[model samples]
Target: MKKQQFVCTSMIPYPSGNLHMGHIRNYTINDVICRKMGIKMFMGWDSFGLPAENFSISKKKTPKLCVKKNIKSMKKQFVDMGYDIVWNKEINTCNRNFYKITQFIFCKLYKCKYIYRGKCISYWDKKDKTTLSKEQIIKGRGWRSGSKVVKRFTKSYFVNLKNSFLKSIIKDIKLSNWPETIKKKQINWIGEEKGYVIKEYHLFFNNIKPFNSLVFSFNNLVLIKKLTKVKKQLNNIISNKNIFYKRNDFIYFVGYKIVYKKKLPVFISDNINFKEFYHPFVLNPFSNIRFKRKMKRKILLNLMFEKGFNTNEIFFKRKTTYKILDWNISRQRYWGTPIPTIVCKNCGVYQERLKNLPVNIKKVKLNNNSDIIKVEKTVINCHKCNCLSYRETDTLDTFFDSSWYFLHYFCKDIRKSKPLDIYIGGEEHSILHLLYSRIIIKILNKIKIVNFKNPFNTLIIQGVILNYSYYYFKNGVKNWIRKINKPKKEIKIYKKLTKMSKSKKNGINPYKYIKRFGVDTLRMYILFIAPINKNFIWNENKIIGCYRFINKVLEFFRNKKNYYYHHHLKYNKFIIKKIEEDINLCYKNFKFNILVSKIMTEFKILKKHNIKNNNVLEKFLNNLYPICPFLVKSINNNFKCQL
Candidate 1:
């Protein structure tokens, strides 16, 4: 038996009709790195999503059919892009076999008491009847359905991320190779905010001792208008920034403390009050008008109680809520994995029997107009009793599918599976996907399902792809162009480099680019144009240089002959060493542009001198094989040389 050398994967693509520039950039980098590692990357699909389901409904096809078609087309494009992908090992989340494993894992976690049914705050789209992530809710509306977002507490399956895993993640995340900004975002999201809530007065304080003035977000306009200012800046503390930024602030009593002593501090507060308290304002004590003195929590509580301020007795309670609360794993859509649980009125909710795993909704019909699943509101009977029960129709969040997909590359048995050598993805996933995966891994380790706490040894975050958007003014109206080239000069045109979007209509159709310039040129030019981890504008003109370089390499291979050589000349070693250095630099800092630029420059020098050394040719071709495999294959076919 032989051990695997390295196991690496890029993020599994969503299998949308055509690959975007961002996909090209990510896959190209992954392909080159895998080639250098002498390992083949596995292509997988994140098949269950809203777009595919919606597309299926619009096309009058089943979701599975639509996904299969998209997957077929995308696989062809992936092969056309020259990626060394393992097609046989491919996994789809919507597949019965794969999601059976997903359901198994869900139940195993439930058995281990890692999952529980809880009420989670979610943004629900009434029209779609689906729960949306925070990002999916744009300006109090659903991004896709254009329905007014209604925030409500929904009963759903959730995992506790704030347990032992919280401490471990914060401690170990520092050792990761993630960017500082990304690390900061993760840390900030998993906030270590500790506070105490005195329900008697609706006051939330950060410190248990309350030595620092506690700032609760007060919404009482009459109270706010009546109070004297603690600081001049405190006058505007009731502004919209408090609501927008989720800032929790304290009240500084001044003008009429005697008149409204009971009503002042006992106002009921909502969830917005539990956030970390900012002590930007001073507190006023009944004894001290200056309000500069500090007192411990016990003293303050006793004084308030004795002074008869609102409450008959002091109620002191410590906070158990965390910033990462109610880690919801449920969605109300048809395209996701059904939550593998059951609810019974007589008995408590429990995992479905292993034999009854993966309550797949593929057979479930969809409403013609609403697009929501049309099925029996009630499902399986309670496993314990023959009592009336219902199956949990809410689907697992797509993140649950992605969090453990990497493990399926080897086998679902985490005890036998090894962590990935490297995993590359975009920075946009730095928050939810990255955090959730790590949390899932930690839970696996905690429950003794897996021996490891982390999923990968190294993680690479890819940058967003950017391009200059061209807009032409037609009859004094700005209209964006969908193609790469500028419009005819008869009309006025403007160009600006920005993020790509369909609404902007500045999207570059990769199929057209590949058809015109060849996929090899597009792959090479993407690597050559800029660093993989930094956003750079797409310049169609810069691709011409890479195109000509590929042509020159092919021409050099065709014009010359291959022969066995005992040793390379001294100058040849220098060029090969420089190539090795650049390759190392690429792996180190993600500077593929520098690597490609260095290779092209050296090849130009070799061409001018008419060098025919096998060492130089082999070195150049081997290095370039990752970036432009089709071009190298053409050369290999002509000369019958082993790359």
Candidate 2:
């Protein structure tokens, strides 16, 4: 019988850098699921981006060189864990073949009129002298050199995703085999609440001071120091970059605040001909951000209501307009897919054509000086008009390559695209990367470039692994501390868990951990620490507990009586049913933590009767394969007494 083919992809990490514990957790979950399902899996590098370029600048190296080195390191890390990876399908987005394929998709959209050029606000890294995405801009600092990013704007291309397109694609997403929570988030994010006034404010601070009427949005009793202060707040409300760029004499904002004498429960907003002033209630602003401070808190909460902050339950946020701004995909530093537009002497600027999709770009290296990096100087012919054009020096957003990357695996050469069976990545990407990829896929399909409207039939967002660091800050003198040796008080410093990274100094190299404790221990610990979609704090005690559990499993198998059964009987049947239910639930709800617990429980229950029970052991071990393949293999061998 021919084996069924299933396409599985890991949104490749930028090979321009090191793998953190979070990466290990993501890849491990993907590997486990694929192995359990016995499907063909693909892994590759999102190699063409900022990290590589940043490395080149700092080390006086080429992006190609830096990315290759990082890939080598990552590959070793993946292989060291005995992952069954399809190296053949491995690709680098930076490579000509892959990038050309991406450009092909871009060209298809551009031709179909779904792609539009627009100016959008972006986080400007003055130190790097480049544009950075929200992800690239770390929470409080620049992702590159820890410099604070300022608000800036740039000319960029956006896939003209329409409401019809978003609704059509997102409406039936629940029908697909994906996590319910994830699907819910996607649907909410593709929010389209119609029925609000389309008010286009012209920053009317000078002349229209108080509107010569009682300030309505705010309560009279909670009046500020003056009405001008209310104007100041309204002006400040536009400070959010997402709100500011969408403002103009034209292009009315998606929604507007509703004034009600009582709890009328209606909201409305629009930028075009669609006109209405009433709609079904969504979420109360008061409930959404009940955890606000003083002053702007109530206003922010009310705005939330106008923006569709549904307070039905804690499971998800309310739906408002799909108000997310277009991506600001330009970066100044070297080492990325060169943004495929060129400035021309006659026509100003235009995207190069499909045939010359990835225009040959000159390479430049970054010196230690952040501002003194060498810029590429070369001219490439524009595919649009065959006019002599200067190449676009700005590189494509790294997220461009990362977004919809899973689609590339379905069609390895995206230039001749295919469909993806499934996509797996960290839950952290659910909003930014996942949403962006969905939008890109929809635009590509709308433009007739791709057959599928959505990229992934199934998306499994693995949970993040937290490297819980115990910092010892005694008498204002901070010192590095390990989890195993730290005092209980010192360990308590980690108030809440977070994703591990270099700046956090909380990440542990998985290989070193795997070597210290066997592969089985490492895998088991990850599974047991948290549910498949929740974050887990990494503690050495947890690893030790996993190691201990493995030893117990081995000891039980070794000492148990050898018994075989042709078929499961009453109690056995019950056990089998429970195991099946657990597996199904684990996949369905993504409850990997509970899944591991069930495995342990079953093993302990059957320990006395399972020495030569190969059938029971096989079924049990196979279920465990996703979590700890090495342990499963070892158990299978020991039960058969072959190794």
User: How well does each candidate superpose onto the true structure, as a TM-score?
Assistant: 0.80, 0.71
Residue 196's lDDT in candidate 2: 29
Worst 10 residues of 2 by lDDT: 201-210
lDDT of 1 by residue, 1-643 (tens): 2345578788897866777787888888989888877888887999886767777888777789889998998888888888888777899999988888889888988888778776545668876777776645665676655567666657777675544567778877887766787788888777655555565444444443322223323223233333324422333544644422232333342321221232232211223333343432112221111111242345544433445343224475665333545466777877888787788888978888898766777475556775655556565657799888988778888888898888888765656777788889888777778888888888888788889877778888777777667777665445677655566677666778766655356656788788888988898888877677778876777778777877878778777755545444445556657767877777566678888877787787677766667766777788788788888888888787777
Q: Which candidate is the best by TM-score?
A: 1
Error of model 2, residue 250, in angstroms: 18
Mind giving the per-residue lDDT tens digits that candidate 2 earns over 493-585? 543355776545677777687778888788777777876667667677668878888888777766642534444433455766687788767
Residue-pair clashes per candidate: 4, 8
lDDT of each: 0.68, 0.59
